[model samples]
Target: MIFLLGLALLRGRVGDREAWHCGAVLIHPRYVLTAGHCVRDPNIPNLSLLGVRLGELNLTTNPDCQLGLCSSVVDVGVEQILVHPEYNRACLACHDLALVRLSRAIENLLPQIYPICLPLDPEGELGGSTDALHNSRDWGWIAGWGSVSGDPFNAQLPTVLQKAQVPLTPTPFCDALQQRYPDPSSTLCAGGEGPFTCKGDSGGPLMIDNRMRTRWYVLGITSKGPRVCGAPNTQTLFTNVHHHLSWILSNLRP
Candidate 1:
């Protein structure tokens, strides 16, 4: 569990039936990144983001353990919910980014509790060629406490956190989305063939694991996906993290 894993967003309380609403990625001791929709959604007006559970591996077990190792699940109340200023619920998928400030900082990090590295970019923009993302050799993975059965409409949270490796894909949605909002940045594409993310996976990170460097970099945030998850020839779109580096840096504070 040295890599990225699922963290659950709570609506009101820890065991509340409606707490397992979305996913997030810990980026700092006191901050986590998630979708703007997760922060505030018109469809779920009654449900509010109240807290988050970090280092949670299995839903059925407390102090989740595996292979003779255990993890400490920590719940931190939400101090603030900062949705992207440009995010529009009316548009649904436009600039879907946000940062949630935890009430307190995590003092220590273990194997099950760690932060994903941000992409190594000098300009806060995608330094690698767009073609690199589409290259067949490049690989990425997504993890979450989301639907394990790949059903978008009827999302069933797995007892244990789910993870899958998905290849980067090139899709026409980027162009279509850009045509509508030319000022915004382009998107990252992946996981059309199979093992793609679903509804509850939203706000999770689309990560690139670099074993050679022993560091994990978050490439994108899990954005919108097809109505029928894992549908043949359907690619998923993610919010490119590189595009919002400045915004992320500006808001990262204790």
Candidate 2:
């Protein structure tokens, strides 16, 4: 996997056993944006919350693919977790997004642990309509250290760098699916059946890794999928980063 500058990846475990599930990244030095579902736990208090680790990409060289035995974490009190105010995990559409701000600014970190550049308004619209991303058969990259497959415990944690080719689903088709499934604000869909992004990969970035100047600017965050991983009708849903650009920037500013 190719590593780039100013891309801070987030990783944490389920329970306390260290099964690294997914990642989020810094959109600004003070705020970290990830999938709302990633931080969801009905019973836990914010005080008992875990800290976020920054930096550390080892896909191509690290044999075990582990971030390291121990990682640096800040006791980020949830302060406020803006879970897409509209998000209903059951409905799974408009509210799949969320933002978390640290109680204080993080200090003394290298550029690798810096924030990612978010696209400005209309920038995300530069590509065509949602239908294009869904049906065109164009290919983009999804990054995460999640399991390559879903055999549960069969796969190890801090998974190897794996990627798959996915075709965009037509917006009309997605709209119909949304009507039936009922996520009206749905924007784009990709991946069907095997070789798609999965459980431990929520909130990860969907990017064009071919560029030389900028690392994949995030277009979407892994939002939803079928009950079973990669089912034919089951496609991965993402929050169109472009649509929420203004909301993101307003919050980022102090």
Q: Per model, how many backbone clashes are there? A: 0, 5
- TM-score of each model, in listed order: 0.86, 0.70
Best by lDDT: 1
Which candidate leads in TM-score? 1
- Distance (Å) between predicted and true CA of 14, model 1? 14
The weakest ten consecutive residues by lDDT in model 2 span 62-71
For residue 130, model 1's alpha carbon misses the true position, in angstroms, by 6.1
TM-score of 2: 0.70
Clash pairs, candidate 1, are none
Off by over 4 Å in 1: 2-17, 89-91, 122-131, 173-180, 211-213
Residue 76 alpha-carbon offset, candidate 1, angstroms: 0.7
Pull out the clashing pairs in model 2: 87-95, 133-168, 134-168, 134-169, 135-168
